[model samples]
Target: MHPCLEQADILELIFKEIYYRPTGSHTEKDLLALALTCQRFKEPALDTLWDTQLTFGPLIKTLGISDAEKESENDAFDRDVRVILTNDSYEPSPEALRRFSSYARRIRRISHVPDARSSILEEMNTELAVLVKLSSWVRSETPGPMFPNLQHLGFIGTLSWTSIPCLIILLESKITTFSMYWGNLDPKESEVLIGLLGRLGLSIEFLELTPLSYIRTPIDPNKPSIFSEMPFPITLSWIIPLLKELRSLSCGSISLNQLALQNLASRCTFYKLQSANTSDDLLEAISDPTADILSPFATLQHLELFEDNFRDFIKLVDYMQPLALQTLILHHTAPPTASTLADLLHSFSEGQHIASLRQFSIKHTVSEFETINSVNMDIVFDGLTLSPLLSFPNLLIVEIDTPCGFDLRDADIRAMAKAWPQLRRLQLGSKIGWGLPPSVTLVGISELLIHCPRLEDFVVPFGARTDPPPITNSTPIKKNMTYLYVGNGRAPGDGSEQMALARFLKHVFPDLCGVGGEWMYEYGLEEEQLDWAAVISLIKTQC
Candidate 1:
């Protein structure tokens, strides 16, 4: 006989690990198999199985609706739909309904993509698209929410209107996180959405909104920008006040109502906030120090800005004097010269922003970073070295990408290591384009292992001129390094100096596998899609 399996927590963890794999045929099959196993694995297995639901169609299918056959029929409405998502006139099998309830409540997150490929409400037709309203119309309905315990909700639909009712139905008290991407919606529909969010009140912690396109056509901006033409019909004031306690917010691709946003920024308490990458309006508002706008980001600990230009960055940070900010993320931007860098550091230090900030990140554009090009450190690097940054008591992470126009090199690297010796994860350079010539060489990078003994991840550019200074270290400098990526493109494409550089890394950072910079762009991948950590492992095994 099999030994009695009493470790329920261990069983749950095992199921969770299995479900972490890519969501495909294998994951579904494995989860189904575990659920069908002994009753001990039922709850945890099911919870893991339903953690990230791509569609609610499966739950409807569990009601025994022959979805395939129904789709084949020409009729827009499916007969089996009423059997489960019924109105006043219909009834469902108690056993089937109970089974549906069991799984629905188990779901903690749901991505209800009920489009043509996974249509549930579409089967009910447009009139019944608002399931809650339809249930009221019929005078009879299910006893519980469609997702009673669902804390996170993400909806993907062809049109903005398609997800509005779906969002409304699931915008219950239990849901704290909501993300949606839809195509279109009218002003009336937009109003309904704003009303629905009020229901969530203080319970909502994370809200992501993406509009497929602007509800109103934007006039040529040669003259003026006005709120009446704002893409979203709903005012930001109405939405932000509702989620006053929001800790994290991502307003995706939606140009917010400026007036409403101004009011919200002045009053709302956001710890971490990110705006879309489309425009500079929001960024402009954040740093605007006009008396009309009180910097509402008084409690913000993290602020992320996605910039496509270089000059705007100077403006964006110039006015952002935060009180509690710790982590700042700047993505996809051009590099700054040593003088410009000094000016920025001085601004933060003089403003007292660096006093509380522990992390400063300037994600530089590819190949354009320049540091060695400067003739004097006293003039260029002085402000950087002498600024408040060197004194940041709590500073732990200093990551800067290769500057867009600056030729970053050895001296710059050494200056950074000397300033922030407490850094544990020090990464510099990018995987793709930066116009400036590479300047960082082995001479400076070697100092990192010597100074920052706790450094765990070191990524730097082995530019065309980079070469390891003569070193015969018998052992690793600081064995704590967990990840390393050196831009080993300095040697000719025929692979001459790469071997020596590889050897240098192998000796210095014992855990390093190989250099990486070309593979990602060659295959066309975004930062999120590329798994550099896994690539490190693969390169290590190959080496």
Candidate 2:
């Protein structure tokens, strides 16, 4: 044996490196070979290999309850699949059960994906049932939980009757993180899930539930699914008090209303919510006039809402004065009007979030069948649309992606740079329309570098047709900026213009990494893209 392998810590690290290779045969093959090589290498090697289990095939193979073989050659679709067939009468010996227990206790995470495409799906469910049945026998003779060290359990695929029992048996009070993305469930199945949550008690800290998917008229048109009516929200409300230790939650919008009723929302640290409900329902859920508390999310540190309207977003910001919030993100389909945007900012100025807020982003996506260019030109974002955000002087990151043109001038850019002197990232106007050329020029960007020397990722629209302002001795060289994007920027695309622009960027941003637009050639920037690409090559040679 090698000297390095004699040390337990060094041997574990070596096995871990082999076990975690992203894409290679050495991941499992090398670990398995080492586990069977000798006694010294066996324990560490097996522990490293069985640390995380994604499927039930390995446990079934170890228990000798099933045999896996390739499908028949006649079946073209499943020709490469190895199908498992269980032996109902088979039972492992005492020595084999002890070995299985040893391997099972080593697992820390079990992420079950029950949507395998081949016959293995049912076979794996059968194998899981067999394992659950054997778990009692093992526990009766040898005491303690089947998976004593399991902490994280995830259901990435659909859940059915056969798989639900497997999850129930694995739901230990010691588990801390649970995430599931199951499809629609019947009333009985939903109750079983609720019972499982009750069993989980206060140990879980991170819980994420993806919205269930359903067909319009799968069985009956008039009859609604059990999950669509009110079982989900009711179940969540019943389980809220049991989750006193939960710190993070991500679920549908209806659950927010339910959470508002419970006392748990006040203690949550992070929330990422989305909704397919109407704007009225969203608004009502976020801000209930009848509620007693003024701020439901006072202790939240991060909040991210998606697929809601601008009105609902405004209401949420106003209602949850988030005293300690550090991050706020909103993504909606409807465009925000100038007055609505002003009201939203006014809420921020009056709220207690001004002191602790560091990152604020709002992204809008155009409705289907309508692109940014096709939208009406009456809706545009100007300097006033963003000036109100200057109230939060501690901001470090700000990103706004609107589906309209920006009428900002040189003065607006300078004002923004001066307001957030500690800003590290500033991205605006991602979907630049084709109405008018940007009035800001290269000189305005120089003002940003002058104020915020630590700015790293800068994306904005500016005119590149003219020469930059003269550099003075007081000018500073900003080496932190890596990527500078000029989306939908107006450029002359001439040799003089390219040379002058390259010299100006090199002097101000000496360590500039890349020069290009955010949406390269997506809209009609083919000519402008070529000009910027040339400037990138010139900057590289000069550096």
> Who wins the lDDT comparison?
2
| Per-residue C-alpha lDDT of model 2 across residues 394-510, encoded as one tens digit per residue | 899998866556788889989999999999988776644324577888788888878987787777778888887877885667777766767667655777777777887888778
Per-residue lDDT for 183-236 in model 1, tens only?
A: 244445555565567655457788766532222232121322233433443433
Q: What's the distance in Å from true for residue 186, model 1?
A: 10
lDDT of 2 at 167: 72
| 10 residues in a row with least lDDT, candidate 2 | 212-221
Clashes of each: 25, 0
Specify the highest-TM-score model's number: 2
- Provide the overall lDDT of each model, using Cα atoms, as 2-decimal numbers: 0.54, 0.64
